[model samples]
Target: MRSQKLYTSFGILIIFIAIFFLKQNFLGEKYQDEHHYLPTAVFFSKEPIPSLDLLKSYGELNTPVPFILGGWVVSVFGENIQCLRLLTFAVSFALLMIFVWGSPDHSKRFFLCLAGLMIFPNYYLCSVYYYTDIFAMIGVLAGVVAYIRKAHGWGMLFFIGAVASRQYMLAFPAAIVAYECLELLKKGFSVKQFFTGLLTDKTWLPYALAVLSIVPWVLLWKGPAPAAVMTMQYYDSDKLIQYNFGYVIYSSACLAVYYIIPEVLITRNLRYFIDFPKNHPRLFIGYIILIGALITLFPAKQAYNPYFTWPYLGYVDQLFMTIGITGFFKQIVFGLLMLITMMRFFSPYFNLTSCVVLINILLLGKAQLSWDKYSLPMIMVLWFLAMFDNHWLFTASNRKQDKLFYH
Candidate 1:
């Protein structure tokens, strides 16, 4: 009862903070997808200009679904920036509710953590913009929550909705496939059960519904080709030929270390003193693959990719802030504790691993001249470390008590 009250208080606090930020004007709200989505709302009721010159010069319909929906919003509520931003604000708030309600273990700390995440570039930027990313993430989070609750049928519906919102959502589907494959392997690939579930399970019904929703777009909306979308139109044959093998090898090594460390720390339930089933290897692997996809999807030349479509980022932002803070006594204590544990357990293999990762980020930032989005992933890594560090501290304390009592 006390915990519930605390969570409620925290939720209200976070919501209030979010409201303040959402309303404040920030440097004129210049970002990608702003132009793309807002105009759909602008010209919805009005007949679209038939001139190919206008479409070519300014607005080429990027995706039909968002435009159609934005058009609907415009028709109902009158076309304006605030109306479009309000739609995003509503979705952002919905995302908060989904995150709070969907959490299996809802605590005050979680809400407080979420409040801190509200300031992340991705979360803040999306909250005030006109884009489908928030909508897509909301669907994905809904699907994840439903899946966790064993409501696979509902989960699939959200999954399909997510994919329909943005086809690049295949990264998440790939993660799901990896997870399911791991489970199947553990069960010795029960063919009869697998086939039966695939054919008759309600979980797959959303996928069926998704097909209905998607078929129209797939058949009628002719925009960019598959190759254009996937390759991001930046990969050049000459660049590939000129690529230095040594540089490639070093960068790859750095990225692997960056992801593997977090996966090892969090996925094993090592921080929580809980044991995950062997059947759930996909949990860690899925996370790793998702991170990899985020990095790779945004190629060197392109500024944005389909990253924010995944909802985990908002919470991940909280994790970053958790690590990025300094000066507080609590922060100092936790930092020392983490430093000691890392030196004790992992230093032998990765004495300079942190430095290497930092160097890679700095180099990448210099190359791109955009270090802001990189903070999203960087902060998540720090949060992963903090979680494990705090877990080990508590575990060691408990073990010490146990030894004293037993002895």
Candidate 2:
């Protein structure tokens, strides 16, 4: 049975790889962000090492890691754009391997979940682009997996790398801290006991290190902040709340249409919830009304102009676009069902991951426009937590142990 499952997973992975390869080759350049990085890479390749002044001149808004990686690739492979895409594909493939390997004892369910994640549209879309988001995502996943396996040192290193790749990843360490607090509470520890435990726990040293990693980036930051960077410029509390509420609704619909639905279909769990509405007519009606109101008030529309060129958008945008009210209804239903499944099957991790994703989305709402690129890290983290089948830190049985850790 295990062999069969492994074979099935490998088969799926092969197909996924082939699809991405074809898309990159036939579809042409689908991401515009590459224009920003390609020039930085070329300049860096010529320099002995990237100086802070050089980065500042380029008006590099984000951290220097992606440019450094891109520079190294250009240095070795020359200036072929396809090489950069291949590099992204290789990193993405590594992320898949990490996901498969991180499963609890390499369980079939975990492998199946990873197979579903690989085919997610946003994830695959990013993979074909020469963007830094993939690197940040891989770093975050590596850190999470390392911490889960009780490798504190490696976890700290990976987490630090993640932040360097994308500053927004600071949310991840905060999420880990929150999860740890919940773990303490689940063990019947008082608030005092929890604080004491947190202060003294050697296992938590890595998180502290991860948090401190942000200091260097902040101190050394040289360029003007990009408009895409999260800031408090639009900090009207009431307006912020209103905008974020709408952003969440719209983002949830996108996730449902592009990611959650595919996951449900692949896991064959759609049938499990098919009779829910029939079982509770009033509750079902209430849900429908609530969802309908949200859709009407905060409809999902393109957050930004298409990241691809006009000719490319003509074909690709239509393929990914969700239509009007009818489409919104389908998305809300599938999204709600996916959330229900996640809570039922993976409550503790689900809640923790949701907190991280929600906080990140709210932060993104401060920007002028919402780009799918900004949400990729959060989405990746969500899928990771959703697919994780091990006992969570907050499980009652796990809490009974004096040392609460995932393994």
Candidate 3:
């Protein structure tokens, strides 16, 4: 009844947002990163597969698959920015649908969250601007969703597609491995059910395909090995390590609070939290940390001073500033939101606020806050969580159905 209407309205809102982007071609921009993909596509009349020499020379570092595909796309569509931008936007939209449909047990709150994700100023702005990163992110999320559902074949396709979209997506594959390993350890080997199949066969298939797929890059690029090594130098960089550590710690702290805190604080009862076991506070937090750190680490470059201009700070601070003029406004808002949500009565509103605050923290710490590239996943995760939380507000006690969701 009320919940269903909320879901429908949210879906409609998503439609409106997509239409808005479609009308303006989002925000058109010059071909970014390497235009090599386009030309390569033209050359092969197929998605350009990376050459062996290219990978060998570059330490097989960073996936070159996306470049190959992008090149092929330009060849098929004719060399034009409009065609490329449309492809990126289409992929992003497709990702949203995949997130919604791919999960079998989604709730009304998930729908609201979906709407929130679509309307994110960051994602909205990026769709207008051309970015390969967004496409790769779509593949990454798709792969994760597929894997979670036991769709191994499709999962590999997505995982490979993601890495090909961007070389750095290796991090996603690595994370998947870790997640799968944990699941395996908990459930134990089950050859009969084929859960073990993922470990023994399907797991390594992508690496093999990736290796074979990237051969073309090495053969073609004849690029400098030093440059490739330099690209990977972040693994050894202290500053990068520090940032990664901070992100890990902060994310873990948030998740611990979300998971450990009794629902009674938010629901005025203990049973709801126990019932809605599918809330996945832990998974949600881990996903955030994994995605956030990868985003920070992989991008070759970042825009200067991108965080100072975020609009949410003013909105958040305004609420807090009813008391005073000076202080870290974002922190004040964050504290207030946490406190309110901690008190069960205002949990629904506060959950949404907490998501926004987390997003802001992510955006603020990073090199840039531009919608052209970053925040696509942040928007998706936030909206998805918000919508799900909304539905949880209605149920007297969490059911098994409520616990199952796309992790």
Candidate 4:
């Protein structure tokens, strides 16, 4: 009974903090993508549903769903940024609730999952203003939550909504597709059986439809996004021909440092990362060769944009720079970590988390720049999937899924 009271007190305090954030947001609104977004939403308020031309009217970088939703908020609530910000907070809160609702394990794992949403860097910050990451993440995540819960029809709609909000969200559905196919193959399905499942599987259809949902927007804009906004985002027809391999390295390193290291330390799963190489020397040699080549040829290039002159790639690079680490030495250290991280996922078996995380990472490789926020879709959902699958987080239970950190 006392523990229950303590939990209630904590919940009340969290509510106060949220209220403080709501008020704090109104005090001083900062700039992110919102400067471009707000104007578009203001125009969209009168229209409510955007015409293709209208979506392209603002120099916004991505899809129109967030603005369309923002427009709806403005239309009903009147033209107040404060209203929109508060509503965005509500949307973020709803996302938390939905995630908690859909969690496979409803024990303390539910509360444990909140840490990722509320406390992860720049995660809760999205709710304070009109930043689209939380909104975008929620859409994809709602679909993902629904998908895992076997609600394919709802999953299809939510995923479509997500892709409508942001094109990068395609990664979720694509990862689902790849993971499902790999699962089938692992279960002794032949190539012929795999091809047959694509036709027969209702589960597969939702992802296919979700992927296809991007087609109309592609046709409307003549590209991944509006051509007008593409220029602003440093994307062009020429960019379609090139890949950002630098991001490939940077993102792989991020998976190691940001995602893997935390879980490893918490679970004390360092042994797997250590022993994997010795057990599989041939794979390690191949990985080392690949990393050596990639690092030599296409090392993580620092973003030159004046807004982000942070000396190197995203968070890890920033940390190293703070500690006076830079240049070739930093590259070698990260390369080794990156090698282990990628190998960790690849070894043992095909992992759903690895597939999704790597797919998100690969998808972001096409992005103009990499930021920690770019990783939120994965971070926001990745830990929950781990928790739900009965992985290392909150490992007090007997309901074990796997012996290792990730299967």
| Strongest candidate by lDDT | 4
Cand. 2 TM to true fold: 0.71
Q: Write down the worst ten-residue block by lDDT for model 2.
A: 308-317
CA lDDT of every candidate:
0.44, 0.60, 0.45, 0.72
lDDT winner, 1 or 2: 2
For model 1, the stretches where C-alpha displacement exceeds 4 angstroms are 1-32, 45-64, 105-119, 190-216, 222-407
lDDT of 3 by residue, 52-74 (tens): 54344433224544445556667
Report the poorest 10 consecutive residues by lDDT, candidate 3.
299-308
lDDT of 4 by residue, 1-407 (tens): 34543564467459846776657756566456666677777878878767766865656767777777788988887777777677677777777766655665334444545664566667657877787777778888898888877898999899898888888898888888887777677668788987887677758778878988999888877778777767655566887777877787777787676567777776676776666667778888888998898788877776565444555677677888789877877778779877867775765455677677779877877887766667778777776776565322222333233254533
Better of 1 and 3 by TM-score: 1
TM-score of each: 0.52, 0.71, 0.51, 0.88
Q: How many times do residue backbones clash in model 1?
A: 1
By the TM-score metric, which is better: model 1 or model 2? 2
Per-model tally of clashing residue pairs: 1, 0, 32, 0
The candidate with the higher TM-score, 2 or 4, is 4
Full candidate order by TM-score, most accurate first: 4, 2, 1, 3
